[model samples]
Target: MYDRPYPGNLYIHEILNGHDVRAYNYFRMPAQVFTGLRDLLADRGVLRDTRFM
Candidate 1:
């Protein structure tokens, strides 16, 4: 996926570039909240796998 974040607060197709990065996609827990955390850490590649949450 492209590294470009959505220009505004609203995140639609243009932000994720076709990937279903919505909160509902995650398996366990509130999709929206966890997805936000995941996006901040995982999708952005900010934290390494070995790093503790």
Candidate 2:
């Protein structure tokens, strides 16, 4: 079902790297905080990176 060449993570990355307001509009949280939370989850094994993800 995942057909987009950019994929979700890449799109998120782009949003995070772009304007802070865009990230907030998309995630409802600041980019830095969101990134920190994501990293924490991944480091704690709460998030996993899959081929399709």
Candidate 3:
């Protein structure tokens, strides 16, 4: 059989983009809050996006 089409990041993107309730249900935080935290960490050099990530 062929591999599944959607990758992990795409799935995450769907969840984050879909609805506030979905993001909250999965992460226990609203989408805005989660994205804010991610941005903060990236600014602090605490998180980096790599090709694999």
Candidate 4:
């Protein structure tokens, strides 16, 4: 998500809540995978907002 900046945000000039919902779907991804992706995003300077994660 972070890699894409406005990940999953297709709306024109609107906040993209799709990625948030995707991340919130715990059943979709493993906990470790989600954490790893989040960390990766943070490390790569994609996750600028800590509160978002």
Q: What is the C-alpha RMSD of each candidate to the true structure, in Å?
A: 9.7, 3.6, 3.6, 9.2
Provide the lowest-lDDT 10-residue window in model 2: 1-10
Q: What is the lDDT of residue 33 in candidate 4?
A: 63
Q: Which ranges in model 1 have alpha carbons more than 4 Å from their true place?
A: 1-29, 47-53
Report, for every candidate in turn, its global Cα lDDT versus the true structure.
Answer: 0.49, 0.87, 0.87, 0.51
Tens digit of per-residue lDDT, candidate 1, span 1-53: 33556433234333334344543353344545555786789867885554223
lDDT of 2 by residue, 1-53 (tens): 25658878787778899999999998999999998998999999999888876
TM-score of each: 0.26, 0.76, 0.83, 0.42
Q: What is candidate 4's lDDT per residue for 1-53, written digit by digit as tens? A: 34545634233112223355444463366545666786899999997753433
What is the Cα root-mean-square deviation between model 1 and the actual structure?
9.7
* Candidate 4 error regions (>4 Å): 1-27, 51-53
User: 1 or 2, which is superior by TM-score?
Assistant: 2
How are the candidates ranked when ordered by TM-score, highest leading?
3, 2, 4, 1
Best by TM-score: 3
1 or 4, greater by TM-score:
4
lDDT of 3: 0.87
Q: What lDDT is reached at residue 52 by model 2?
A: 70
* Number of backbone-clashing residue pairs for each candidate, in the order shown: 1, 0, 0, 0
